[model samples]
Target chain A: MCLGIPGKIQSIRDDAGLVMGVIDFGGVQRDVCLQYVADEVQVGDYVIVHVGFAITRVDEDEARRTFEVLKEMSQLDELEWMAEAAEQGMRGLEKPA
Target chain B: MKYLSEYRDADIAKRLIGRIKTRATRCWTLMEVCGGQTHTIVRQGLDELLEGSVEMIHGPGCPVCVTPLEQIDKALLIAAKPNVIFTSFGDMLRVPGSDCDLQQVRARGGSVKVVYSPLDALALAQKHPDKEVVFFAVGFETTAPANAMAVFRARQLGVQNFSVLVSHVTVPPAITAILEAPDNRVQGFLAAGHVCAVMGYTEYEPIAAKYKVPIIVTGFEPVDILEGISLAVNQLEERRHEVENQYVRSVRRSGTEPARALVQQVFELANRQWRGIGEIPMSGLRLRDEFAAYDAERKFGVGGLKVTEPAACRAGDVLTGRIKPPQCAAFGTLCTPERPLGAPMVSTEGACSAYYNLAKYRTADPAGAAP
Candidate 1:
């Protein structure tokens, strides 16, 4: 029951005094309770849904920091590749400037 | 999946294992205080990878495994009543009570259902106004928020027939009990990351300072577990004890305040009896006096039921890390997953079930090759 999936909110509604939303987890969509994140969540925001409840909103900066920590620990080699690719993309944009 | 799939990468796990090996000055014994962490460690063969570097002992973190037997009996008593629907998480269906479980109760024409959330049980009460809908609320701090919110909503909607049989526990108290034991050998702990996500790491700092053990909040993945182990090992090597967070992406230092407020509004502290371990003060959560009307025990009048565990089951030893699952005499012979002599063998997050299902630590070198 502790297992959670990060899903994007597709839609939200309040019916019979309950805040509910349809969250899309990968390709599957399920209804989730939004009482916990009702103040912060929007229709397009991502959330961590556990046991049919949206427990927390997803943060991009925190996600990036996690990858950076992994990189520092020599765990994520993909982060290095991603950084190199971003640098090349930026160079392409710089030549015109 | 963004934050999760990356942590489970095999290449990352390999690198973290190498780092863990280098950081280990000697064989250090560490206990992960969550059954979810135990399942991940065994299922991914992480323990096998860190064979000689460190020893990972399982702790009493499974809610179903540690739920007092009398609570199960009380749930059974309420479930078998006429015009009542007993709802619980799927894991609780097979957990044995005194003589029968909820699954058997369903087979005998009892109105039992499996719900993913307590809110669903409240919905059931709304649908069937004539029937009583009782939810088996069992978990740690990770689950109390939702359960509390359900009760709060039920009161708002005036859902008279919906109630909860609560068996909520906290992680910090369990850690203290384990450390205070006379035979305790745990040098450090990998605290449950999900619990920390709700209630924060502030409660763990005092425990770490008092017990003189590093408590690291960790997630349920290969890299997370290895990184937490490495952090704890670094502390043990430096002779320092403090609470650290390895699952920084999801968990904050103070946790989610709104969830904490909701839980505090609905529940209060109470002494509770664990299934194998007796009573620990301020370990369990009970519905507050204002929400007492929503308590299944008071509503259904099933409070006096009690049952004793079998003498053959040594779940207490396995829970406290005193012995491995294979060391128990009735482990495979009488306590298989199909017919568990104890709750540990039945719970999906339990250490014994993880070992038995994966066929781990069954070789000539028992105890998962721990020296």
Candidate 2:
């Protein structure tokens, strides 16, 4: 399975020298192995957990930037659609003849 | 749902689709090398929406679907033993082996358990020191690190009862296999984002160069996939072949170093056999010689069992994108999620299962994979 779900790390602790933590995935919580991302991730940080391991700590700023850019692109396209629709409306007023 | 729900934005997905349509002068056949992305494309009808612009070929990225029958038989053999407690991810339970599936063994009083992680199987070994716990470790690079850690931990703490039946396959080699095929029509690829998150995109640069194909490391969400398709289409339009990263937030160029390092420590490259596609040299991973004691095949003596694939199932064609699941004569009638003739139907992420589960694409959908 290649699917990795993003979740927030609620708490962290060492289990026999491995960095283990409880990851809250929106609501449900699971004990995820944070040893791979131990250096960069701490409590309250978001990470992509796959098969009980935190593969990477999600970059919040970068994530917000990516989403905002998508929204902006959508907004720009909406503007384009409005312009085309208005132009069509203007053309229709030229009369059936 | 902060990071996830935002990526499913419908407006963004539609805009990206519009952009991809505008950029393509001719229909480009692109393959998404992860079955998760295939599921997203089929479930959302993303392929249908961008019909003429792009053709999405489902690649052999489902681990359950591609894991060779011999390995499944070994897993079955081990599970059937009275002293062995076989554990695997839930999805692998129904994958049909040569004789039968792991679920059948479980039905016949076998101690088979579905574990969320390899570590959970290791925990079972610790809990019951008398029984031998064998975890059927099968997946791609996204799962290698976790399975590696389980073996490392077992050896570190002297947990002798634990071992793993590793059938891990990497993505790049499989991609190469597809591009090298004589009838290949794929011009670009959407690399599995999670796989890149573990192994990074550096390995893909050389592939893009030599093959002259664009490889976009993409995520599993609708918007993420559409953006990946958009990037690949843009590159094709300009005749630019390179490795692009559409999933910037989670994946880094170097990937998670610790995970890669640990996986390197535990596993090594070996010739692997894919169920439908036959053998691809060095496409799979096996536990290193140092961990032979933890290798289930060595411990159980089930390493030499080989069986032929049933002729009724055209998994090879479906896996290689030569034909769509619905195109298969046995797809819905002879083979199904209920009584799967092959692994593709049993696996949730398999292309066949995706096509079967998504009824909207069943009626010769123009956007569905070509014959």
Residues A7-97 of candidate 2: C-alpha lDDT, one tens digit per residue: 6777899999999988765455667799999999889888877777889877665434443443422212212222332343311011112
Error of 1 at B48 (Å): 2.7
Interface RMSD of 1: 14.2
- Tens-place lDDT per residue, model 1, B118-137, is 77778778888999999999
**Docking quality category of candidate 2 according to DockQ thresholds:** incorrect
Each model's C-alpha lDDT?
A: 0.80, 0.83
**TM-scores for all candidates?**
0.87, 0.88
Against the true structure, candidate 1 reaches a TM-score of 0.87
Q: Which runs in model 2 stand beyond 4 Å of their true positions?
A: A59-97, B1-8, B360-371
Once fitted onto the true fold, the runs of candidate 1 whose alpha carbons sit more than 4 angstroms away are: A59-97, B1-8, B360-371
lDDT of 2: 0.83
Q: Write the per-residue lDDT of candidate 2 for residues B1-371, one digit (tens) a residue.
A: 12222344656766888799999999999999988888777766778888999999999989889988888988999999999989887788888887789989999999887766678788879988999999999999999999999999999999999999989999999999999999999999999998999999999999999999999999876788999999999999999999999998788999999999999999999999998899998999999999999999999988888788778889989899999999999988998889999988987678898788766444656445321
